[model samples]
Target: MLKPPYYPIIYVRGYAGTQEAVEDTVATPYMGFNLGSTKYRQTSAGKIEPYVFESPLIRLMKDHLYQDAFHDGQILPQGPVSPRSIWIFRYYDVVSKGLGNGERKEIEFHAEKLRQFILHVRSATGQDSNKDFRVYLVAHSMGGLVCRCYLQNKDIPDLEGKPPGDWKKKGVDKLFTYATPHGGIEFRKGFGWLEGLRDFLAINNADNFGKTRMREILSLEKNLPLHSLNNRFPAKRVFCLVGTNSQDYGISRKVVGPKSDGLVQIENAYVKESARAYTFRSHSGAYGIVNSESGYRNLERFLFGDIQVNVSLETLKIKMPGKEKNLSATYDIENNVSIRGLPIPVNKRTKDTFSSSFRSSDTLEEERTHLFTSFLLKTARLNKRRQSLGFSIHFRILPLYHQDKRFLPDRHYEGQAVFDDRLIIEVSKGGDSRFKVRYGWGSNNFKATKNLEFKVDKNNLSTAVIQLNQHRPVNMTAAIRFEVSAWN
Candidate 1:
């Protein structure tokens, strides 16, 4: 039987909302909206109760307790075992006052407090004496950032230093983080406009905690290289679950384009270079990914899966108009065929002058930029497993014809391009699974413009086969065929 895990899980909540308000305030901008909203709430004398999202924490505790009751007999023979414990770390001052001028100081203090809490837990449970005790952290929203501060801070000798000689030999592991922006949020653009406005307010600006300061601390390009929390901890043992949902809040839904999990964009949630990132949800669970069953399952898989998950950019393509001589040229994805042999325009009096001028002018740059922007706008399949089925539909624009006169006027023609891709996963009962991807791109050019289609099916585990087809206009006489194959 497999030995039970040696350590318990620690849950951390995100910004503004506490473990209690997770459910209701998730879709809202908790921290960005509530900053400086309260006065006389932070008297230094006794205690300052801060506003927080409590749903995530409550859900986490309840889920674990439920699991313990339901699966009590599942525990294996091990060195140490008991019901898991959870401690909610509250910072009313930081939440109510915002990051303000002393944001870094406040965060540092909290990090130390968390460190002490961890040490205390280790001591109270007598697990520290065993030298085999492991602690796993799961944080959401800004909580993940706070956790990073704690783990990566250079001042914290115990955390920053290498594990004890005995513990190192025994192998201590850490797994934590969910929907945390390893790459800081795009506060300068998009819906982040409000956050920018808040940064200008004095009552909100307590100190360096303003938007600029937050940006400085969270800047992935800057701080990541200097004091990367993911690197500070063992990456192989770290686990992260990101969130993505296309739907946004009522107001944001109309403003933002494409997809987002309300507040955090999907791209921001998953740090490509991080240890392991998965998705079972959107960002608004108020940093409660650790508390959900799906979250726990993903966590368990990351910690114990026979193979780790790998996600990467698979393919990219762009289509553009061919030079004059190759007016018959077309774009195809399957057969790896590209337009070629377009005779260069030679004379100033011929129709070739238009094509030559178009290629020589800034039009080419504009076309290239348009193509690049279109590719970026396209979204790829998410969370596709080795043997899983997936599909995506997107739109593109194709240039059909253009007319230009030296001094008079220039005419332009374009057509709409639409396509859908389908993926199939084939796996033998006892063998490895292979993915078959097929895509079809169709476009209607001009009256004489043909309807073009391309298809490719590849054994993602092995080789690729491609094919192309075009339906000529009823009035057209020309016909073409293309086919190709390549190996990785």
Candidate 2:
């Protein structure tokens, strides 16, 4: 039987510029969803290690008993298909020279077609009941924008001459994107000249990435930003997997610049208020974000996990030695979160990789810094003895002093961490149906050694806090706050 939150998933492939590229994309059965990696970075230093990651498509079938929506050499065949199936949007097929016309369509056209495809999948899966039909949209690059265009643009006219606004009724449970340029793609080399040239040519509708075109497609006002979902879609239901490795993205990185996944800047890769993760992966290639182990791990957890955990550093007070007022210091917090059995972290931001940045004193005055949010599958308990899910969080704080806008070399130490620690957390349900959280400092032991007090509100939300202490010259008092609740 199909399960809730394990409903069918629709994979949307990214941009295909030329007719040949569209044909190549259409020829693939799973559209790169079945691609896997044989190696991964073992450390933040870009150390390559041999590790086999069976692609997300195969893993879903083996781990969750999910099937693809293909039968008898045809997709969505005549018979009833499994509700727990995977479907490819195949939006570009219509524009592929081999499949349909050689002409191309705008992103709006692809999105409208996507809506039709979803409805067809719903019918083919025999999920007529509104409550039983739900699908997860997983896209890469431009495909993410297509999904957003469909979900967020309420005024988009359908083929039936009706405007689409009942997205919730269409049963889109959640959306996940890998290395999508949510804020539109921008090149760093040119002072807006290169972007203007690309947009003017409109090659393969490249103008879709331009801010003016983005506003039109997303139905946003001139005052609104390109990344804004316009409050049409729930920000919590979206997850953006950002890639941080720019060196591996080929010669394009020379123009795209650093601090990017190669093509999309890190700052432009995600929507505000949405959950996001950073990994040492590139935009496309062998080191691409879509085919990596970290990508699949985060994807499965966000799609099927029942428990949601939001971790943040709250109530911060930093004290520098022999200085109290007008302290010219920059602080950076590096964090990594990994599941119990995984060899790699699902979310990582380290100082060595240049993914973590220094926080200004003005921001610290607000006293809250979000670390990262992760989801845990309740049924996939790592600690069977305790019937709980387990994960560990590592934190490193680095501070650099400055005087008169000039670096003080004497006060800075290379590769120095002012404060560092790891917290191991195990969460399970108590007898009263409330959540029970157990945690311990990893420096103390490998397992949780203390119970974390949690207060369950009437809405079934539970929250806890852990204080981080022990620093030398810098007396910093910061508490890690966790808010846990049920997720689809």
- Candidate 1 runs further than 4 Å off: 1-6, 17-105, 159-172, 188-197, 200-230, 234-239, 246-259, 275-282, 285-297, 311-488
lDDT of 1: 0.37
lDDT of residue 42 for candidate 2: 70
Task: Indicate which candidate wins on TM-score.
Answer: 2
Q: How many clashes does the backbone of model 2 have?
A: 0
Q: Using lDDT as the measure, which candidate wins?
A: 2
TM-score to true structure, per model:
0.48, 0.92
Q: Candidate 1's residue-wise lDDT over 1-488, tens digit each?
A: 11334255555566542323333333333222121111123334666655332343344344334112112332111223342544334433334333223232355566666666566545544565555555556667666766666665555445324432222322235645666755444432465555555556523222223435543443334434422443455544555555444342334334333334444544455433455433333455332343343344444434333222121111222233334432321211111111111111100111111111112222332332111000000011143333322222121212344455567666555433312222121111123232233334333221212222334355222233323222322111111222212210
Cα deviation at 139, candidate 1, in Å, is 0.9
lDDT of each: 0.37, 0.83
